[model samples]
Target: MRTGGKRTASVFLLLTVLLLLLFYCNLALGTRFFSPAKLFSLLSQGRGNDPAVSILFKIRLPRALMALFLGGALAVSGFLLQTYFANPIAGPFVLGVSSGARLAVALCMMLFMAQNRALSSFALVFAAFLGSLVSLGILLAVSQRVRQMAGLLVAGIMIGYICSAATDFLLSFAADSEIVSLHSWSQGSFSGMSLAQVRTAAVLIGISAFALLFLAKPLAAVQLGESYAESLGVNVRRMRSALIILASLLAATVTAFAGPVSFVGVASPFLIQSLLKSNKPLLVLPASFLGGAVFCLASDLIARTAFQPTELALSTVTSFFGAPIVLWLLVKRRGK
Candidate 1:
């Protein structure tokens, strides 16, 4: 057992190193050519008449930072939801939270654009929060009477469909320009992230991530079964509520900043679990965050550079990788 534990720790450390390297590489490579040598020199020299330095500092940094926080937030949310629901396939989107966020964002964008009013970033964030909470409330109500995980999942999907229908109805009545904006927002992109937005996301995601870390032990206990957790002196109800709130906040913030970049919340935790060969939240949670950051950064790189001069949607890149993995996991579990 000790040997196995040591191996797991080593693998996690190696992956963490690789993730950090990829992050720096993302910083180095972009549309503009900033050679590694020049980038290093510019950083060391403080302020210089270097256009590359300015671009890196102003443009690339924010986008890369946004990817990091958004990825971490999605992965952490995935981990919490999976553990709480005891379903490997469970995710933030599974509970209709992302759909709720989409609805709120759609309504806000349509109303603001139609009124010719400038929409503040805060308004967008608040809209996402409100939408996610509405879905969460419905899910919680259903869960109270439905003891089966499968039943809860169905409730979530039904809620998602309802929200989607409502969003489509609103879009039909919206102005052409508003519809265009909504379509773009739904596709999900990390581009055009300002430093201020990145900073805000980072702070919110950071705090939420820390909260998850602190609850890791309790979460693992709850995974054994709520009654078992209670026997161990764990407040199952409080922990469950905290997990929902944390996951909702994490998902809402990421959707608000990065748009509804799907599958990260469904895929990242599973990837980390496979890598570590363990479901202990203490191990899975942090590893999922790092894995998520790596996955998103790599996906963004492909989205930007895959088809020269033509950027792809972030969702498209992620889905190409995420869909196959999810199918494989489903088949493998079914065969067992």
Candidate 2:
């Protein structure tokens, strides 16, 4: 319709292509590489009892799907936080939501191991959600005290550090035998995703994402400020509460499965907004979700392939790229 709209449309098309390309690369390239032709052949043959087929079906496909859903959910969650706080830097990791979730999951895992009990998926999500809410509560309280956005951000980072320290403290008391497994989860990963886990993430993230979409209009109004949003008939208090719950739920889901993959939440929304050149929630939300899927899929690919036999943690790669973007944003904001 307009020049900006055409630009946004073109950007969306480019992101879609990039997402597909990254998805294929993640499935095809790993410790053992599979050519695109081979990947197609394996999949086309009804996935018979072949080892490569098993790897494709059981490992790569599930892992890729997990990245798409959880990564998108994390991004959408971050956008929700950013909208709620009117801060570009606000995200699950930056605000300590992921750290809190990680801490809770670690505690649950340690407790289960100590008692020789297995932790269920539902229990893991519940623990993570509880911890995320705890962190969000502290964040909101701190936000009230801080007049400047930077002050709030610093407080959020401090909260994250405290949660991380607590997690490390708990790990120190873990049994030596259990340390390896717990350590892996704490580092954040997309590995070992089963079909069941994928299905579960899909349902949780799908619902959360759609719910967010439903709130897009109100959220956009909220972004304009509480007074403006109220003038527009948006219930500011209820909207904020919903944002917190939905954002926390999505963050908890990611933390529960992948142990808090970093920076996707922060980076994706900003990147999409830049490309879209618009802040309209209807456009930004969907683009951010796709961009997030691409970001994590690419990061997961690097995590798996960069070190070859020993995989780098998913958060490691994300933070490497994400932290700089954040610094640049802070600098740009200051420039203004």
- Count of backbone clashes for each model? 0, 0
Clashing pairs in model 1, backbone N/Cα/C closer than 3 A: none
TM-score of each: 0.91, 0.96
**Candidate 1 local lDDT, 1-336, one digit each (tens):** 998799788868977887877777777876776677877776687666777767777777788888888888888888888877888878877778888988888888888887899777777878888898899898889999998887898899899888878988998998877777676667778888888988788778878877876798888888888899899999988998898889888888888877777788888889888878898887887788888888898888888778958989998998899878878878987899
Candidate 1 residue 9 C-alpha distance from true site, Å: 2.4
- Candidate 2: which stretches are off by over 4 Å? none
The TM-score, computed over Cα atoms with residue i paired to residue i, of candidate 1 is: 0.91
Top lDDT prediction, candidate number: 2
lDDT of each: 0.83, 0.90
Error of 2 at 48 (Å): 2.7
Identify the leading candidate in terms of TM-score. Answer: 2
RMSD vs true structure, all candidates: 2.3, 1.4
